[model samples]
Target: MLITQPSDLDPASPGPITIAQPLLDHLAAIRADVLASLASGEPVYGVNTGMGALSKVRLTTDEQKVHQRNLLLGRAVGGPPWLPDDEARAVLIGRLRTFLTGDAGVSVELIQQLVAFINSGHVPAIPAGGAGSAGEIIPLAHAFGPLAADLGPKEGIALLAGIPGATGRAALHAARARRLADRLSEIGAGAIAVIGANRGPYHPLTARGDDVLAAELTRLRNLVGPEPDPRSLQAPVSFRVAGPVIAHVRRTLTHLEAAVERAFTGVTDSPAYLDGEFVGTAGFHGIDLAAHCDHLTAALAHAAEVSTARLHRLLDPAVTGLPAQLAHEPGPQAGLVAVHKRAVATSHALRRLTLPSAIGTAETSNGQEDVQSFSWEAVGGLAEAIRLAREVAACELLAVHQALALSKRPVPPGLQELLLAVANVVPPIEADRPFGEDLTRLLDSVL
Candidate 1:
């Protein structure tokens, strides 16, 4: 966890430090090689010629230096609503990771400046949208625009050639989603215990050799206590399938982790230095990251749907064998009816956010950059989906806690601990009051 290189920068780490020696040595070697290549007068893309539509246009030695500065200035077209501090840090880390691969043909001085920028904690104001290229040209331009005067040789193309913006955003979302998935398991166990769900569904014999299901069964048994008498012949599908649904979410997260790992270590620049020569490549593409983000979005949407169903069951008298809406006075008080509506609305929004952004593409850059990953749009939508899902989870926890309070059956010790935490912030709903503040407190407590 020392963060000696870009790959060592953890999402949870507090801040950046000075670059270590091993990284400095690799950078020195790469810079020497790039200088050697330039001395040989070999035609290299972005170093001696124009970029994109003007690749065939060669440049004089003096013009090539000017091109470097112009590259950064021309692409600084990012808009408002800047990326937050943590995400901005992630963006720096992503670019630094790619730099460590020694494929961008940048100088040691430029690398040190980047390290200084990160360590000083001064995040550039990178706008929120406008990524239409194979690589994220606009955002990268804004991020590195302040340092444009320092760029040399092919460094300008190097800065814009990687998908760091998309990768950083995805990394932050993945970290948050992973934490939420863990909390989902605990909340699901509490809901199952409160509902008096049949132990039969969670039995080891019924797990079918799936490790995630088997693990969930053990967790539910511990929370609710073993061998509970069923309230009905069978519980609702939402109650019975909570274990499997959470298991699927975990599986999706695993796939996303693999994609993120690849992004961290892989070379994602065009005209990359590989096998001792500068080679043209499509390494800047972000389809793997974008596709996995779409998958995570779908998984979260499904979890929201399941949570809404469970909340509905808790509100209905026939399903829970409790008074309607968990009302203190069955006649006058409205109880959790409004809370149910809020949860339903959040679930609907989650579904809308799940439409895959990677499925569509529009050609830009005069058809030079025809296909795009749209990974930024995909990660942005997924981030919103995750936020809505957290709201849905808060609603379910509130309703389940209230339902458990109304039940006369003796609660297990483990469940009592969970109930104590919920009751600390969300008091038993005896009458109708503004539950918005209560919901916010509950979300903060649980998440």
Candidate 2:
């Protein structure tokens, strides 16, 4: 709970920062390397250096501060009007990380200031948009601008280092779309585990899975409690035909998790100048952080598709055995049948966000910028997808809980705990509660 460094970025951690002494040391080591390179006068790129396009330009000792200041300032360009505290905090953490990597030359004192700022809750202003994921310098602009008058050494890259807000908004959310989508996917799985829609679709040996699958299936059932009116799905619906759908979604969540892990832990770096002497590493290199991200998107997309399909099955009067809308009154009430439509729409919206971003590399940067990953875009897409998945989960969890209630029969032990928790939160449909409000709350819980 006394999180003090970016290294402590657990899901439960408030945002993108945790600024501890160890992380500061790691960052300081990077700075030391940069300074050592500069002191050696070894023509190190940024340290004794010239920047982009001017990779050949070397600076005099007298101009070092000016050079560093200019570099930092450029990174601060192009951001939106306002950003949330969490995102600003994320930017601070990213800027600190970049400087720590020795990739950017910054004083350790600045890192300390950032740590204090975060701990004291004095986050700066960051714009919402203007970053395409290759970098988020604009927000970094917001991050460091005020601290350094919106312009300083290595400022340009700093502005682009961290992402915008961590949450999903319609247009301006950051590159976390995939992580959000992964979250949504897991919630979808959780909803499925507790709800008795179609276990038959995912029987382990029935499809293609190993001992792990068997274990996961057992774990899934145990977590949820049990199927209500288990008799209805005792055959193919419960454990037979549903195999394909369940297997497909589980596979997707696993993939999505892999992607988020990569994003969280992956290090993307580039030679401020790719002299090839230093390998001028293009974090924008052969590695596809974006590709991995896109893979996650594809998985989440599959999860959304399958979950929505299951939702469809629940809505079908012929399938779930619930009154048309899981409502006793049906036609008069509009029931959850309409909510199912919204869920499908939400899933589709998430799917739409999954379109790959790395495909469209910027054609030219004065012949210098050959390819751009637009990684921010890819991350952003997955983040949006995750949010959509959450909405779908809200729909699914609610739908199943209602169905179980109507059955008035003992739900299978596998789904009992989660079902009861859900039931307690919203209860089996009382008279016409505003489901939208309830949905918002449900998603907040899972996502």
Candidate 3:
């Protein structure tokens, strides 16, 4: 990958990174300027002076040389569940973007070592949880410390300065959430067919100039087509509000996408070099990224709750006018009743993760670093939410497939393949055999 700009970094790409000589030369010049500032007997925050609580303490020449190395070794804390290979690559890509602009004043040699590590296709075992530092020092140390035996003046601080741990995972999570969002729309379309819900709410004019709602309405309209003989004049609130709820998810996703883009492209160096002088900056703080992640997680949890409501509707005899629970015989075979229970459980679990991680604050490093973004926790929460959200989708699909089968209504052409796929893994609720295994298969092979 050739990185001419921060936007050039593609975390999803498998790569050996390459930088043009001019950019490398530019970085070298910045390094020289930083070194000159250090040589003039002036204090630079992690160079000739101490860091954090010891910022005012001056260092000897020998201490200055070893400070960079010690910074990484001392900060490598915590243990596994290390980041998976893809997320590790993303962290590396985020780190590389920090280096591209030379604001951190990192050496080109250090930059090359980072490139070499990426090109080698091996990642260090950086811990995926228990990260509570002011920035991402713990994970950053685990990721980069072993690669370089020695680091120049500002290189160590540069490596530890940004919240790449959060940014990298957020980028991946936002993409994953988007896919989940689209799949939920398709699943909602299936439920509409099975429920024979009133078609009024899906009318284009109901959108009221909201593009996201309009798009969802169009999708549902096309998928369910003409519902000539609807079961009710107005469906349950859950069914009526499906379009708006899904449109809300899309909006939250849009907010996350914008935040991730800004993080990837913005400078995030603490004590960044500006106008040929070292200056402290709050660029390391990631409140925007953290809060947006919380928003998306909460939105997904709401979607799951709505999906569970719709699943319950499919089981109600009054709603569907079909056999209760879509069972062949309601007495001996419990049918999809237990499935709705599981949906309820999963939906509640997802709801618990909606608490905002960004609202919490802590003091560390002798109170020199007094507050944190809790960005890692935010992204991690979303990751779990994605898994639970999909499981909820699986539950709703099971009910939709069973209800449509018992209804004897012709399946919509758009939903034929989906119901057919569900039927492949989740055989009809013929005698209420263990549904846990069927749900497992649906999650593994289908959803």
Error of 2 at 27 (Å): 6.0
lDDT of 3 by residue, 259-354 (tens): 988887777887888788888877678889989999999999999999999999888899989899879899888989999999999999999999
Q: lDDT tens string, model 1, 210-245?
A: 887787667667776764477777889998888788
Score each candidate by Cα lDDT. Answer: 0.81, 0.53, 0.85
Clashing residue pairs for model 3: none
Which portions of model 3 show Cα errors greater than 4 Å? 14-17, 20-22
Q: After the best TM-score superposition of candidate 1, give how far the Cα of residue 231 lies from its true spot, in angstroms.
A: 0.6
Assess the local accuracy of residue 120 in candidate 2 as a C-alpha lDDT between 0 and 100. 74
Q: Give the TM-score of candidate 2.
A: 0.76
Candidate 1's C-alpha runs over 4 A off are 408-411, 415-418
Estimated TM-score for each candidate? 0.94, 0.76, 0.93
Worst 10 residues of 1 by lDDT: 9-18
